[model samples]
Target: MKSGWMRGIIILLVFVLGLSIGYFLPDRKEKMDVPVASVGDEIITELMWLNQLKEDYGEQVLQDMIDRKVVFSEANRLGITVSDKEIEQEIQKMRKAYENDEQFLNSLKEQSGTTLEQLKEDMRYYLTWEKLATKDVVVSDPEIEEYYNNNLYLFQEPEKVHAWQIVVSTEEEAKQVIRELEEGTDFSTLAKERSMDLLTANQGGDLGFISLNDSYFDPSFLEVAFSLKEGEISSPIPVEKGFVILKVTEKVKERIIPLDEVKDTIRKEIALSQVPSLPQVLDQLRKQAKAQILINDNGK
Candidate 1:
């Protein structure tokens, strides 16, 4: 049986080791540690598990640790350091991608099965790498403009429509509802009275916004929705669920994200692109530090 403490440590190790070779510190003294668990009458010891892991992943794990150490040392020698503020900014930046704090933490657990602090440590190492790699990289105004021009689509927003829908069971019913919508019957009132969509029936059949990019509705339906002017109602559109009648409430016109607005981001992107990849940087560090590996896989 595994001791709870050792089991907890192993759980941490599963993720901690995934992000790092930093678990077993190089300076920590090795020991012929005693049993940390027992299976029925037989014993399962710390040394046994350690040796097992070593046999399976010792070389790769050892290399990761060595590489981490070299990266840290090289960054230190070059006076490259990341601050607490920078780390927090990165953390918050990541959180923005998630809908809420719970989602953010849940995603962290699912992806790495690790705590926030451990993820931060991993991020700190990543930031350190970025600093070391792009420390001397420079991108000029011309470079930014050229890259922006080449990737113009990346900087443009697609046309989108904020619309509502009344989904009914049959095409004739859909057409009947459309006639009501046109002949002075309120769209929202009809939607609440007749729309079969329980989700949006109460909200006046609101399907929310549909864009060329959003896949919420059928692509053909979205095509018709975007084509209509705001307040215009569509004819019955056949779809997988049922026939849908859409009323455009808001049409956000497509616009080019101005050059000034995205120039800084473009600059950093091109600069990072110029920097060597993480593995290549680690390889360079290995040569610079004259790192060597001699792990014994025999579990001796």
Candidate 2:
């Protein structure tokens, strides 16, 4: 579960309750006028469901709320703060892993049980605490070199190709272009004049370098690109939007990423890993602040 969260980048643990700012919501007695579920003559009302959820998970949710408050206050005391633009930038980078903003939100709802607003709020706190925790953290060059040597597999590169393309609406059109190429017509000239792909049409159909894992292009197109030898032009291959004629410009062998490029990332990992877990850090801060919780045993 922890690994899943790490991969998904979904950190909010508390679910549906995250959407609302207040944990202990006021009575919705008027809205409970209708039945949520009915069994013969008996009915479970909306208020009942809400009450059950609160009774079952309220304590944990309240604790999460407390931790958030503690972290934010501690950050403020230390004159540490994160701006909306920084948060948005991080969110945009993460969102690139998804198809679009809508899909990102849907994934969040399904995985972390949080909305966009709640995610922003939680992210601010998490960043605050992370900054506070790692303020004095240091990772040496030796440590980075050691980690890079031991974890070379993690940097292994996938197959990649550098290719050019001219996309057309029909296989016949693509084949006609291939024939033109065979008859000594320049691919880039024809691509600039007639290719239907707007983005690359003016650039002489240069798709640049791409790998199998690149989300921008179709897997089938990438497969055909990599299969072609350097300087070989492909037969028309059908894709989602249209048929494409490809020219293989270059081929790259799989290789590990260099250590110097990933030094900062490795340093962050080593530093954060050395510190107490976020929860533990928050607990320590709460203790320092002498924060208290009052639970009414009279069945709140």
Candidate 3:
């Protein structure tokens, strides 16, 4: 009986798979029809929308489609029309972000299955909706001041130590180096001659000003480094691979940066923090305008 039930479940699973396969299979005989949303005459097709979503955010493609539909509906109601110049600027920004890599450009083209022109058009629409949603938000001077006061620690620099390091692969070699250093041999010269970390060895193992918040070095080494004063050298600290000797070149005091220097940055951050409320504002604007979505094809 159990074997029979398992066979029945297997048959049902296969039938579902067959239906899914049939649904997705393209028809060569018929011309692909454009999907129309209920609100507008704009023709959005399944392939076109899916390709765009997959190109930009593969993980949240479905959520993106839903959000795009909502944005489009809201945009129409709000009379949020994006200008050609605005679209061009957005495309320019995106191009700059990916300019260093040819592979990224090629991958975008391949994933979208569209020309660069189409991609720019989509970005224009996206940015247009975004602009409409953000149109009414105003950050007052008081709000900025309050935010700065509340988060003063965020703008304050932490105490930091400027240090030089020497790493070697063996304890005996490290002891020998430490003996030479204690006898007044130059740390930088010894680092250049013996340190194993190639990236820093060339710079005489100078790690530069290491903030207390820096987690790259071993905690044991950091504890010792922070306790030392400027121009002081630490005893050889043992690690998994070998021993490390650190010299404190300088120390920096912690202090808050002035608000004038970071005013614009703080304002922008405050604006971005309020981004979640944009769609709500857009919805309010949408109630005053007219829009529609015609097709409801759930393309997987």
Among all candidates shown, the one with the greatest lDDT: 2
List model 1 lDDT by residue over 1-300, tens digit each.
112222233344653553233346543223334567888988876556665666665666556667668888989999999888778877886774553455567677666565577666666777787778788998899999999899999988877677888999899999899787778999989989998876678677766555676654567887898888888888889888889998898987889889997886687688789988867877887998999886455633
Model 2, CA-based lDDT: 0.75
| Candidate 1 lDDT | 0.73
Worst 10 residues of 1 by lDDT: 1-10
Task: Assess each prediction's global lDDT (C-alpha) against the native.
Answer: 0.73, 0.75, 0.66
Which candidate order results from sorting by TM-score in descending order?
A: 2, 1, 3
TM match of model 3 to true structure = 0.46
For model 3, the superposed segments whose C-alpha errors exceed 4 Å read 1-138, 179-186, 275-300
Question: Which residue pairs clash within candidate 2?
Answer: none
Worst 10 residues of 2 by lDDT: 1-10
Q: Which stretches of candidate 2 lie over 4 Å from their true place?
A: 1-33, 36-40, 84-103, 140-222, 225-264, 296-300
Q: Can you give the lDDT of residue 30 in candidate 1? A: 39
Task: Give lDDT: candidate 2, residue 283.
Answer: 77
lDDT of 2 by residue, 155-230 (tens): 7887777788898999888899999999999889989987998667767887766787887877888788889999
Better of 2 and 3 by lDDT: 2
